[model samples]
Target: MRYLSLSLVVVVLVATIGLGWVFDFVYQQYSDPKQSPSEDKIEYAEILTKKMAVALSSSNNANAFITAWQANDGYSLQIDSINSLALPAPLLSDLRLGKSLNIESDSDLNIHYAIPNSSDVLILQIPYTIEDNKKFINRYWVTSLFYLLLIVLFLLWAKPLISRLINLRETAKAFGKGELSQRITVGKVSYISDLESEFNHMAQRIEDLVSDVKLLSTAVSHDLRTPLARIRMGLDTLSEEEEPAQRRVYEKRINAHIDDMVELVETLLAYARLDQSMLAIEKTSIDLFALTEKIIKNKQKERPAEHDKSILLEADASLAHCFAVGDNTYLKMLVNNLLLNAIQHSKTTVLVKICCRPNSLVLVVEDDGDGIPEDIKVDLFKPFVRSKANKNKGHGVGLAICKRIVQWHQGSITVEKSEQLKGAKFIVNLPSVEN
Candidate 1:
């Protein structure tokens, strides 16, 4: 629409300006006063001056001049007051001195002479009898054609844009009425192609979010049943148990179920918070190398001795302060989740590598354990997607949350088979910044 409007404006300016140029050229050629008096006009001035002198010889005024040439058709004459003429003072002086004057006329092809008859000025004019043989374009016809063409062209330009806008409005209405799949078909060079593309993207994002919410609700309802069943069973057994220790055992089991439910609810709330706050990320410069190293060391120290695994970190010496632009809090969460996930599944060593590219920093984490199986790999990053290895062990939202955090920072996270560690390798790439 913007492009079309600009084109219309340019057309208006060019057409009007071009027409003005043509109009001015024609007027200058056929209408402006001629610059030079012709030789015929000089000869007529001489003849008419003498003729007027003889005609007005008696009365030396206009009444004698009028009576002498009233029926004359060889030329035309008119009397005018000296004060009414715009002739210069010198020209008037010459006229009074009995001299005839020749001058140009406003019509490019006409010339006339002025003669003083006594105290009066007699204007001698020969009618211009040249008729135009060819039909010439006048302003009325040209202006009508300009308006007609402009209207037709404007309608042509408006039709496509109006149709697109109508389609857009209807699609928006459908989407507003809960048609989650509604989307506009994009055109190659539409005036509002960018707007269409953005709308499509927004629709897709909204659909995905709605679908995730439904899935989350279903998963929550189904997942809570097991713990609730266990809690119920524990309570029933506690009422039947006679010994204090047996009663205490049942209490412990019931408390554990309640704790699991609390944890699940807390995880869902946290995810909700993260989703809502995505656009409000508090951006700051962060030293990714240092941040990742600190997370790795802290998790390594926090792990129990019995489930020990050698956690390793590797990077070039120059990457001690590799900088990136992002919210530090979420970046820490992303790094922590990846590391915890690595430690949970690793059979031996959990290896991490940090490297810098021309415009980004890459962090790779690989675990020396069974890699992601082929069956569950497709939706491994979606919320609550559990692998057989970790089935019923933990809610499968860690990877999904990590993925969201990376995406919120305008980065990417991917997992593949590890060549070096013979397990899952997670790669995260974030835009780098100078320190």
Candidate 2:
């Protein structure tokens, strides 16, 4: 904060100093009596000198000539010599240069006028009256006051911005020390508000990535232990069994455990990779209704006929022609995972519904089963999080992968208790084709 304030002060000071120099230079060149006559002064002096020379051509009285000149002018004049006046070197140089008029100043400015080849020079003493002094002081004082006001206004404008930057620096320090949740709040009128917003977004992404990595570590340790232990136990059983049939059974059990571990590892890898830069997403226009219908058909075929009677997969007619922007393959995977999740826990039926609004399409997958527990619903989208009811069914990366895919599509997915279906409702919103 202090550094910013000091920098602003320095800038204001430099600006004021530079402007002051410019104003002083202009005044000295055009308005100061000590300098050469301006254009107006030159014309006035030439006209006056011509009249005086003509008047003196027929008269020899210097006093009468000086009186006549003084009668029409505002200044006092006298005929003096070049050597007696102790004129400055510059005026003496001007006299030697054969110039028509010579000007010189000491404590006060004066003009020396002499006709060519005349030994006596006419001296006009320019006065410094109280009014002139007042005007000079007022001009400089007003200019200084104006510059001071500008500096004050600049400081006022910079104060809030500097304070915000200082706060942001402290927040960054805290974030570096592991306060991943630290974020800057943006004010509407802030000069760096856009920068602050981008920083907040970057910070949030970093926080989420760090959290996902930690959760993946913990989940791998906890979920893999059971399947690995079972695989070991199954191998031990096969080693002890002499009967071929029992050995075959133990071998199959071991293979199933191996498959579970493999599937878990693959799912975790996919969920982790979904956030990476290398993941290619080819977005095209995908009909939401047709996609939902296709997923329902595939899931129905995968379900056994006996279970079909209890768990019916139905796609609402509203899902028929609604279109959205998404990668078709990833969209299918998203729908499949969501529908499978619904079917696995549903009691009698699972419903896939797609509704189209003006700008967006909503995909809903819900079932008539026990609703999600209130405690776990909030974290359902997080990696390795699952409802207590279906904890043993699969690795918890399915919904997390769905969430990552949804985010990639520039959309959002949320879970809530389905009021109509009386089950866990998953609502996914995607940009409509017309959007």
Candidate 3:
């Protein structure tokens, strides 16, 4: 494409130079003669005037003046010695007022002379008229047509190649964003064939690595969970009366450890399934406002009596009618995780707000509690990441799962300080179905 554009530029430069030369040549041909008035036709006119002056001085006869003018091809002249010429008003006035002595015809073909010796004046006209050079004009037009054809041909030739390159770039970008299944299609351009082949090999390798990692994670979780479950069962079989408090303590510790293991396994499984290619997404247009209301109501039912009144749900009615393109189950999971996290950490009030924007559906959950610690905020989305400040809370898989789910939906999740309340705010931005 660069070479083609350069070639086009060169062609345009050559055409411009050629056209300029042709126009210069035409201008030179039509320009006034370089010879002075005394050397060219003007000198001839002066000689004829002298002859007419001598003829009139010797014989006072107008016939000799006419004969002298005719011998010099003066018949084509508009201004002649026998009659006073009707000059343009300005020129005639200038001449009568003694400001100038020459007059030119309207076409600049003739030079009229005032002899000051005879009533008959002398007029000298050149027989030159500008004619259009068809050959030169045709050459210019042909060159222009050739330049236009070259541009059209370049576009026709490069369109597919350019599109293929762009598609390859987009596929690489998508793969970088975790779309491991994407592959570049073959194109006619042989220049990037090696690149395409390498890219395909890399994508295949990535897919294999991801598959192996997932299989390994699944295997590890299954193997570890079985032994962990056996440990729990063995602990449960311990007698309660054999140091009852100590046995109860031992059982609680074992149960807590088992719970942590189970949470870790669940988190791993969720992360592994975050790949959209692995997921069977059944996208449907869901009314998000009603869905959110339903989630809040369910949460209210599940929470303690005092907490039910503390949950504040505020949604724009107009925005409540909005829809989103997503797997309903995944959407529900996302909402539930965010709300549960907020409710668990909230001190007094938990606020849920749903609003619709031009490009996205916005769900914000804010809690009036100690916000996430500033130090651990950066690693909050990573699996099993728990801040020392909130370490006693449930295992830190909820936020990671939330991140994975939002990413799979091509949406975003961000944590910040709430504007309306002094607490942590979790904002979920899902792409609008209407958009």
Best-performing candidate as measured by TM-score:
2
Clashing pairs in 1: none
- The residue-by-residue lDDT of candidate 3 on 1-435, one tens digit each, is 454466557656655676557666866686556534333655565465445444444565556545555665434433354335565677655444423244445444454544454454445555433332343465577667656765676576567657768888999999999999999876664446667877986796577557647654655666477658766675766643388777787777677768766766775666556664426877778777778889988888887654644878787766745788788888898889888888777778899888888778899999998998988798687555667677455656678778767866778899999877788999999988662
Most lDDT-accurate candidate: 1
Candidate 2, superposed: residue stretches over 4 Å from native: 1-46, 49-107, 110-114, 117-123, 278-287, 301-330, 357-359, 408-410, 431-435
Taking the candidates one at a time, how many backbone clashes does each contain? 0, 1, 2
Error of 2 at 59 (Å): 6.9
Q: Candidate 3 vs. truth: CA RMSD? A: 17.2
Measured by TM-score, how close is model 1 to the native structure? Answer: 0.69
Alpha-carbon TM-score of each model against the true structure? 0.69, 0.73, 0.50
Worst 10 residues of 3 by lDDT: 127-136
